[model samples]
Each structure stands twice: as C-alpha cells, then as structure tokens.
Target: MASASTANRWLRPEVYPLFAAVGVAVGICGFQLVRNICINPEVRVSKEGRSAGVLENYAEGEKYAEHGLRKFLRTRAPEIMPSINRFFADPK
Candidate 1:
C-alpha cells in the first residue's frame, strides 16, 4: 500500500519533462526501426521480383538506406536559424 502523496508525486509538473523526453525517444526509435524494416535492403523482405546482380544490390542498398528527407536536405544549407545565420554572415 502507498500513501496518496507518494502516488501523486509522479503526476507533478516536474515529471512532465521526463515523460515528454521519453515519448520523443520512443517515437524516434520506432520510426528508425520501421524505416529500416521497410527500406534497408539487408532487412527488407523481398517478394517475387526480378533477380538483381551484386552491383545492382549494392546501388539499391545505398539508395534505400538513405532517408528521403536526408537526401532532400543534403543539397541544402544546414541552417537552424537562417535569418540569424545570414545576419551574422553578412559583412558590415
């Protein structure tokens, strides 16, 4: 048996951040697992398809392993705060 205060301690505002952090971590891990299962050639389940050569498999693995978002961003500037970056980068 536990006291009401002891049970209520877990619901305090101070515990909310920990809960949020855990939720985010779980979500990220789940997404990665699903992505790998779906696209990572080594882990992806193959159906009846045309047999591929070794070179083709390697090329496909590289393409499928890269997330679409990462591929899209690869050509773009890595800027978290674009406005601030431009302001600081500009010569007076």
Candidate 2:
C-alpha cells in the first residue's frame, strides 16, 4: 500500500483549477438561490400583512423584478476587451 505522504500528494497544484471551477459553480448557484428567494417577485414569500399574489404586487415588484446587473447592462454595449479595442482604435 502507498504511504500517507503519497496519499497527500493527491492535493497537488494541478487540482487548483478544478477547485476554482467548483467554487465558482457553487457560488453562482448560491447567488441565484438567494436572489430568487429575496428579489424574485414570484418566488419570494412575504410575511408582512396579507400575502398577495404575484400580480397584486406588479407596480411594487417592478423595481426588483429584473436583476440589477441585467438592468444596468441592458443599455450598455457588449465589450469583450474594451482596453484592447480602444488601444487599436486610437489614431495615435
């Protein structure tokens, strides 16, 4: 059988990317879960006063109905590499 030192070798630098990928995936899922529970009008449940249907809160829900990032980016153009594009486009 292999020694304990050899077993510990499994945690090498090569595994860092996999770890980062998993961390990002977990973080994204967690963020979506929290956003849905807190900001999503349809998924959210209110404990204040009488609970209303999704349609009842239409005007009030309009604020958080769309994701903040999405709303902000909606009016912006997509830029893959703004710096690089600017550098090449410069006349200087």
Candidate 3:
C-alpha cells in the first residue's frame, strides 16, 4: 500500500501550477461575463395609464401610443359594462 501511494504522489495538491492555471481560467471567464452584462443596455418602459395597453415606441403618451386609438374606446373592462343603478349610455 505504501508503494502504491508513493507512486500516486504526483497527483497530490502540491501541484501549484495546475491549480493556478485553473483559477486564472475561472477568473477570466467571470470577468468576461460581467463585462458582457455591463456593456448591454437595460430596457425601461414608461407607463401613462392603467390599461395593459402596450405603448407605441414613438408615442410619448398613452392616448397616441396605440394605433387606431381615435376609433377604440380606451376604458377599463369594468367601465365597459353598464352600471346597474344608473341609466346606461347607448352601446353604439
């Protein structure tokens, strides 16, 4: 057993160069990951209303954000239903 252990002694952790090379490779990969993330821009959205309406990139405000907004009613789902206690407006 002693002879076998002595033969495998080269695999001992006293090998500093192997460990140093592995550490340097990991450190370089980590640095590259951080550098790539920092170089990318973060996405930001500006909301101007309560609807889940997606804003048009060129329009700054909610009203003009969606195309054909002049034709569509821009009310929430609850408001679209008639009020039970009050006179309802014509659906048209």
lDDT of 1 by residue, 1-92 (tens): 48887879898999999999999999999998998777676663555332442334777877875768889999988899999999999998
Please rank every candidate by lDDT, starting with the best: 1, 2, 3
Error of 3 at 31 (Å): 0.1
Q: Superposing every Cα of model 2 onto the true structure, what RMSD results?
A: 3.8
lDDT of 3 at 25: 100
Give per-model TM-scores: 0.71, 0.64, 0.31
lDDT by residue for model 3 over 1-92, one digit each (tens)? Answer: 99888868756778778878998999999986785454322222334342546445443344333436344555534454457424655453
TM-score of 1: 0.71
Worst 10 residues of 2 by lDDT: 45-54
Clashing pairs in 2: none
Better of 1 and 2 by TM-score: 1
lDDT of all predictions: 0.79, 0.77, 0.56
> Candidate 1 or 3, higher TM-score?
1
Summarize candidate 2's per-residue lDDT along 1-92 as a digit string, tens digits: 57877867767899889989999999999998998787676774656533554467776678776657889899877988888988999889
Give the Cα error of residue 86 in candidate 2, in Å. 1.7
Worst 10 residues of 1 by lDDT: 47-56
Error (Å) of candidate 1 at residue 8 is 1.2
